[model samples]
Target chain A: MPINSKIVRRIGDLARIDLSITDVDMFSEQLGEIVDLMNQLDGVDTSSVQEMDSEIGNGHENRPKDIVNEGNCIELILKNAPETKEGFFTVKKVIE
Target chain B: MSDLASLTISKARDLLSTGEVSALELTEHYLQRIESSRNLNTFCFTATELALEKAKSCDRLMSSTDRGKLCGIPLAVKDIFCTQSLPTQAASKILEGFVPPYESTVTERLWKENAVLLGKLNMDEFAMGSSNETSVYGPAINPWQDPNEATPLSPGGSSGGSAAAVAADLCLAALGTDTGGSIRQPAAFNGVVGIKPTYGRCSRWGIIAFASSLDQAGPITKTVRDSAILLEIISGHDKKDSTSVRCEVPNFEAALNGDIRGKKIGIPKEYRIDDTPAEIIKLWEIGINQLSDSGAEIVDVSLPHTKYSLPTYYVLAPAEASSNLARYDGVKYGYRATLKDDEGINELYKRTRSEGFGDEVKRRIMVGTYVLSAGFYEAYYQKALKVRSLIKRDFREVFSKGVSAILTPTTPSPAFPLGSKNKKSPVEMYLNDIFTVPANLAGLPAVSIPTGITEKGLPLGLQIIGPAWEEANVLNIAHRLEKDSNFRIKPKQWWTS
Candidate 1:
């Protein structure tokens, strides 16, 4: 049940999140407890079960062609951008 | 005046058509009520200018008799949906100032029907908690409260604000999304009818993704008929949402009055949990008895997979949600938490996300990540999904065996007090969705109707779930029960009281 600092750091890395030692320790215990709770699913027999990737799979047969931003209110969408400039959202350089 | 508070869409439409009340007047009435009841926390944000503008347009359309089904009806949208002009924060600080430039398909459809927009109702942050307590704006107060209790009771979450707004007569009805009982639970808590349509019936585009696979936007309304009309307007296919169905969307409003004279209603034996309160059990029995007396056959059906639904939902929903919510990395759309010196972009994302999401959401995200991890994928996430299929198959088998619909209590108990946080253990809190989560897992349509009240006088709801796309059948039975029960239960004490 004790999620040590190391495991927390690994989890933080996996999730692409940075955690302070204090947060790492606190989240470790909390996440550990939640995992312990989720461990209850171990007893459930899912031998014949097929994983549910999507909840509703009935409607894809006649789906329209992938509408890339089709009929979308462009101005409305841009309003969501916190740093849009000239219809493009500006972001810090990732590769540089 | 058509008593703005008690007006149904059908009535409002007829009156509006006859020039009884302008859309502007109806919008103003509700806005005034919202202003007075600001302390109720029923709404997160109100777009008065936008609403007035839209109402004027609706009035202009009415002059030309351009009345669509939801024409002139002012709808209070749940904060979960994105609006172009409004801040679409899911009652969370992470997305505090984030405004979605796009509109959710449901909201867009409402606008197409000339439905006047009222405002956004508050909700639990990211639709995680039951009590709406986790919301950054604070928990919404139930319109009704016990005399002994001075503090506001929880209006049930994630859709607590939507339910409270309708129950308090702030708006005709509102949109709410149900992912693991979000809509139905709050409807039960606030004594309103909430329907979570069969998955894929309504488009999920524009609604903030909670549990992608399980989430469906439905109407939380005062009457089953109102919910049906709202469903008719909102339920349809959109090219925007890949998951939307191409099947013929039924005329739900016309089907509302259909005869349920001899339908077979299944009583899932597993729904009667041992921990359910005696009063709730009694209420369930009364509902069953009422259905039976009305010429519906009550058959004991076994959904053997029922017990596994909550756990399956917990695993599956979090797994999907963790993936869906990965888009909100501060830089793209939402709030960015500035990292300390020496920290880079990765650290900023980590800090922002960790700080942004609340405990329950974080816990789910972690579980989701853990389950979807390479080593654990096959064992956990994949395994839970398989159980999910079996659960859906169980409902199909029951409905196939001459059962038109399944009946059960929405929650194990009535609304707990707002701060009754420590009363139930986490597992117990998870069990609150035991009855409702199965319908979502199966992608079947279901509704929660206020069938009865507990001995202590809090409202208890009975959920009626039907096979996929059988929304009409479910609403018919619910309407029949609504009339038969005649519970006439209102909030115990209004805000003024």
Candidate 2:
């Protein structure tokens, strides 16, 4: 799992973080080292082990009744938005 | 009044009850201390007016029969926890100016207990780095320095400010989150007490999520008893966070009876890695002897999967962080990059994240994205999950063998100079969490108590880890160690000068 500049670029795109050529080269080298460190897991035999997704394994199914417990404060919800129009969070046009 | 800043929460509570010190007087003393100690860079935001208001209200209720447990105690929290109408930036540029409209459940609980807030402490951006250098506000310097040497040392990180502020007596205690070793490591570095309870002991709702499963809010305090008092207030089930366990919050402070008789304290041989400084090993031996002299039987145990904890944590935490951080695009809250007219939504996300995130945060996001990508998910993320299960099973085996708690050195070495390690490689910095990450993987309760000092006069800590939901047992063992070790060393208050 050698991370090259091309793979770093792809990862940057997937993560939606813009990276320059210098960042790509630097990340390729650094992430290569981190990946090498993570490669230690390949040596351990996990065949018989169950994958522990959450520390508290049994609590996922616990859900409260479906109801709108709290809402209706549009001002509070949009308070921190970078831009808001007509009480909705405004982003660059998704489709023009 | 100046000496009021040195009192622990327990002592302060007694003083408040006896009418010897009003809550307003205590709050004013800490506010003055925080104002004078600005050079340490511990507090990013100081809510002086709000703290005075809260303290006045607390003084009004001083004679009431029903009062909160932490009624007059002044404390600060890592900026990662949301404080409603106050700045809750997570110490990252991306979250700049993002004041959360609602309080985090943990902080809400603290308020319900009538604790005074001295505002938010600084931390690594998104709690990613081992040193506090990644904070947008700059690194929080450790108060402890070699008296002969002028070079400042690091307050081991992520929760660096929380630990440093408590060490410097800027606040009585501070709340810090431990995802890997964010709480314990800094506590070790600053020569204070910190505890990370079982994973679901405290609610995660309204906390700026780092790694959801691993992130837990705990207290960094001047004493083990203060840690227990704060932990009791913050622990319990909350409807807002489903992961918060539905269990009884024990009387943790009351459990500190200093009785460890017949308790089997485990010393896992696997923690003894080569190249560890002789001071750390020697401090660990002193801890073992202290516990043994206190009548607790020391047993040799094996947690063989311990070595894989750091690798597993690195894989899982970032994969979750990459997903959690995806919400910080330009659309909603926080910083948004200025875009050219032709740019669209994707460009908005890219530029905003690139400009907003720090280097270590970006590096983690990259590793997380790469690992969770289409082809590498099973090899990295899935394999790490199984190794996590093995690590949990290893702890379970030891605890099942009647081991009451496991004692280990909290960090590999004492605090170093601020910029010394992270320069060469990020992996060098990652090794600082080696001794503390295993408990997070297993989701157990662990505490760090300052028990020894390095030859350079920097403090070293010994960690006591207990079974899941057994924070009471863990605190009791630590309280015993704290009593036996009698560590009373405080950092020189050079910052105030």
Candidate 3:
């Protein structure tokens, strides 16, 4: 495997996600095939190719100030939060 | 009236304007069609009452001088967009009930033109899968069939429901966001018109983020004209999305004169894949001859880096997706797991995310995190970025040859049996977007139009890709091709009694 189970676990931790034992096994196999697919990029000579940092949308990076900057949905945004109190999101306490 | 939903957006526009049909009546008609088409599962949420009410108001407003081309036209919205009253879940459990109080900039623009929202359509979970099978509500079935066999076929994803709805006549048109062919692929599968406008042509403000750099909102409709008109209404400079271009919004519909007298159409040599079915190859030949017959010069082009696009996209998209989707932790919003008495914050994040995201989403996020990790970043992610630039340059080079558009088969095959892809490995399914991904990777405009039917008795689509910010050109060529193909095959009403 280009990537192993331990590495997959490490990735899960970084992504703030959990993988079931079955998913871990399945992903290990699936991602191995996918990684092998990624290795195909090694065959291409991209030495002179400049890495794409931005994107093709609106080739111009410079823009005037934002025309609409209203983020006034504090209440509406909080409506879907799992736990909320006084307009702030709540989570399990970590520090002792 | 049962088939009133089958009317094209342009025709419906004319009908409503002439008072031949009230917007209320039109909305009611589609709402009933939507109810009967439940077996297709095209809609994730139907805004029946709201649609009727909006149609009533639109009817009343028609008494005055204020109106637009889309006034009183009923359209379906992909669940990915955040509509005020409609819960935009993106067909994933994580956002099961995550309704935004505000509307997406694109959908907001729709209402500005008096277009009625019929409901939110279904899609892949977080727009991750090629087959709609990844959706939490189960796969949205392709309405196309072989007439005799009862085997359910898939409407391609991640905009599966949007394509299915448009194909099945559940809505005149729908809003579908494309990242790596989500919009175009499904449109091809369902034999509908779907355009993925040049990146940043339409604002990405309220549409849920997938691969942020690659995701762009466009329209899926029944005809080239409808897609063009919807694209016009939904596209513009939005201060909310800084990436939106300052380029003047052209009269997209008016630009559809179908005059391609001297335009050069590119046929990429690399797109002739070894595994492509002979039927699809024949369709491509037919499309080429038709375009040439319309007085357009046909030129063979080469996109050497085409083979690398899918690999590079898989790497970069998931990497960006991992970063973009990081916001779904338990604290901020979306689905969260119930914390046990002994649970801690770490458990909160993991349990919530594990419970929230589906298998495909989780796989991508893990792969994304893996590629971006310290050691692999140089070997994988950075390399993929360089390769991405090569892929983009390939399109630039071809366009520089004075090629206004490149013609290719939308899907290697027509729509497949719904669960057929499930039996294969994820890599096999990822191969489904082989042709459609290049345009997205280049951030160029592309459209899928129904070309003909396969021997399997299913409809197939052909794709035309254009240079960045050249959607008008792409649509014009598509409009020309639509007339040439004269494809009028509709799916047999097998699902309805």
TM agreement with the true structure for every prediction: 0.94, 0.98, 0.97
Model 1's chain B yields a TM-score of: 0.97
Local lDDT at B302 for model 1: 95
**Residue-wise lDDT of candidate 3 within B1-497, one digit each (tens)?**
33476689888877777788899888888888888889999898888888888898899888677775578899988889999867889888888668788789999999988889999999999899888988999989899885556778899899999999888888889989899999999999998999999988899998899998899999999999999899998998888888887678899999999999999999999999999999999999999999999999999999999999999988999999999899888676668798889989888889989999988898889888888989989888999989988888889888888999999999987888867765437888999989988888888999999989888778889999999888899999999999999999889887763
**What DockQ do you compute for every candidate structure?**
0.47, 0.74, 0.73
For residues B2-60, what per-residue lDDT tens digits would candidate 1 score against the true structure? Answer: 57877877788788889999989999998888998888988889989999998888888
Model 3 clash pairs are A67-B239, B153-B418
Model 2 DockQ class: medium
For model 3, how many clashes? Answer: 2
- Estimate the TM-score for candidate 1: 0.94
By TM-score, is 1 or 3 better? 3
Model 3 regions more than 4 Å off: A56-58, A64-73, B1-3, B422-424
| Candidate 1 ranges with C-alpha deviation above 4 Å | A1-5, A20-33, A55-59, A67-96, B423-425
Residue range with the least summed lDDT across 10 consecutive positions in model 2 chain B: B418-427
Candidates arranged by DockQ, highest first? 2, 3, 1
For candidate 3, the per-residue lDDT at B427 reads: 85
Better of 1 and 2 by TM-score: 2
Model 3's CAPRI class? Answer: medium
What's the best-to-worst order under TM-score?
Answer: 2, 3, 1
For all candidates, what are the clash counts? 10, 0, 2
